[model samples]
Target: MLTNRRSTMPMKHVRMPSWHAGSKTTTSALPTYTIDNTPKSLTPAILTSTTQSLPGYTTTRLIGAIHGTASLTHKVPKSFMKSLSGSFTGSWGEPKPLTQVLYQARDQAIERMTKDAIEKGANAVIGLQIRETEVMGCIVVSVSATACLVEKERRGVKRDSAQENPF
Candidate 1:
């Protein structure tokens, strides 16, 4: 009487969501400057995409590397908050609690860098980098920049008098 017995079970398939997109990201490279040994008077040189001119000097070797670092620790003051939101409308009243403090630190770092560059007799600065670090309960902002004296090669030939002089 037990002719045939069968059990039927359904099969289920589950699919998970994906988080990858087809776009690719790329990073650009930084430029390297050649250091010069001889000290050359600082002059403002025009920067062109095709070529960069270094200071004009005989010895084109690295003389010295000057760097500046600064750190600032500050607590947000109530006075700063009052001024944060000018009488202007559509303004976010005052900066978030901690933002105002950070801004102060950034300004302090920049000022220090400027002073250091001037003291080192550097007319222009290159390879400027900045970083902000949080330690303990205080935030530390640090900035670093390279100051160097550059020289350019002098052309041998000088312009000669014109064949015909115009009155």
Candidate 2:
């Protein structure tokens, strides 16, 4: 016959090693990242496009060539990596996470380029070229443009409109 025994010793707090601790994990909810299209250093007066000249403006003087570059790595946010894995299996649609990262990088590059042009005393940027490249699991955006001074073209008044305007 065996007799049950009990100990009167008080229990001490014990800590267990957590596998989840120290390991980066991604949750189902995507990270909130706001992309600001407008930059403090850039303004609407500064025109940018992939063309030789601005439509309603004339390039008076070509200041110089200005370039801006920005890059984002795959590991920027661990959540993106996880989302990317699952994103590949979905139907044809926009990749919100990846697109947001790219847009952020592009916007930053554009802002930098415009700032550079503004420093050079250029009112507008023409022949703008934006290139996107992937390097070593990173997305790189490069923007180049010819900074120039542009003046708005004056539209000649028609004969009827001119006669209507009495000086």
Candidate 3:
């Protein structure tokens, strides 16, 4: 029973549909998806039979790709934006020394992304991607990563550093 009126209607196409809108889906394991246009779904027809398992670490679950974004505007004073002193990295160009602004924006973006993952109980993030853009005198950065919990296989024992071996 769909309570939201918007959900009850036939959903408008948003990009290519990953799976049929009204079908019982089989992908009960995948938790996240990216906007990448990679080779289409891995159908059973092309299934590889020789899959080998790796060791040392086990992936307990996939929480999906969590994302965070930050935007900063270095409002350029009329003089700064129009003046020749800080404007232009080369001999000729338009507006302000942006190297520092870019750095700060990028760092803030990454910090937010990691904070998001931590808040969601992710031990680590993988497949990280950072994107940036400059628009209307503002710099915007966004970062995304696959957040998952990976547990390491325990060995025989872990000894404390201060413990002496009773040989």
Candidate 4:
């Protein structure tokens, strides 16, 4: 028969490794939201290009492929006011609310893709592609690119005859 008894030995605290520290779950405060007034083209810290390669920079290493996507919905209004404004603005007319929504979605997708590239230690994203799809009332935008490291190509200066013969 075993008797119920508490161990009198001192308890030792075990130190966890650095990698194991993040295994514990913790509650965090919700992030604060703010309006971003900066232009989308100027927002990314990493260089992005639609072409296979950057114009003036050479790829040092390819990190990997990354992707991002976003979706938004807007009801298209058929009203006399819109037609009147469209008529005054000529054949092309003013941008529709739907178009604006699509643009916002595209910007958000690209921003997310850029953030992914940054997190992966990439300095640039090449072969960037943005695809838009309209499903029901929602417009979804997807962005894809290859994250890579790039360096500017160094060009040797052309020496003129006068400079070469300078006394």
By TM-score, the best candidate is 2
For all candidates, the clash counts are: 8, 0, 0, 0
| Pairs in steric clash, model 2 | none
Which residue runs does candidate 1 get wrong by more than 4 Å? 1-65, 69-74, 79-100, 150-167
Candidate 4 per-residue lDDT, tens place, 64-108, comes to 999999986554334523633564665675444334445666778
Q: Model 1 over residues 2-86: C-alpha lDDT tens digits?
A: 2223534444434333543423222111111226422122222311111222345322232244343445444434444454443
lDDT of residue 33 for candidate 4: 21
TM-score of 4: 0.57
lDDT of 2 at 158: 40
- TM-score (C-alpha, index-matched) for candidate 3: 0.45
- Prediction 2 TM-score vs. true: 0.64
8-103, model 2: which lDDT tens digit per residue?
A: 565553543466564545443343454662222323347886888889786778999999999976555656777666667758765556666666
Which residue pairs show collisions in model 1?
Answer: 36-61, 37-61, 54-151, 54-152, 55-150, 55-151, 55-152, 56-152
Which one wins by lDDT: 1 or 4? 4
Candidate 4 total steric clashes = 0
Each candidate: RMSD: 20.5, 10.2, 20.9, 17.0
Rank the candidate models, highest TM-score first.
2, 4, 3, 1
Which parts of model 4 are misplaced by more than 4 Å?
Answer: 1-43, 75-94, 157-167
Cα error, residue 117 of model 2, in Å, equals: 0.2
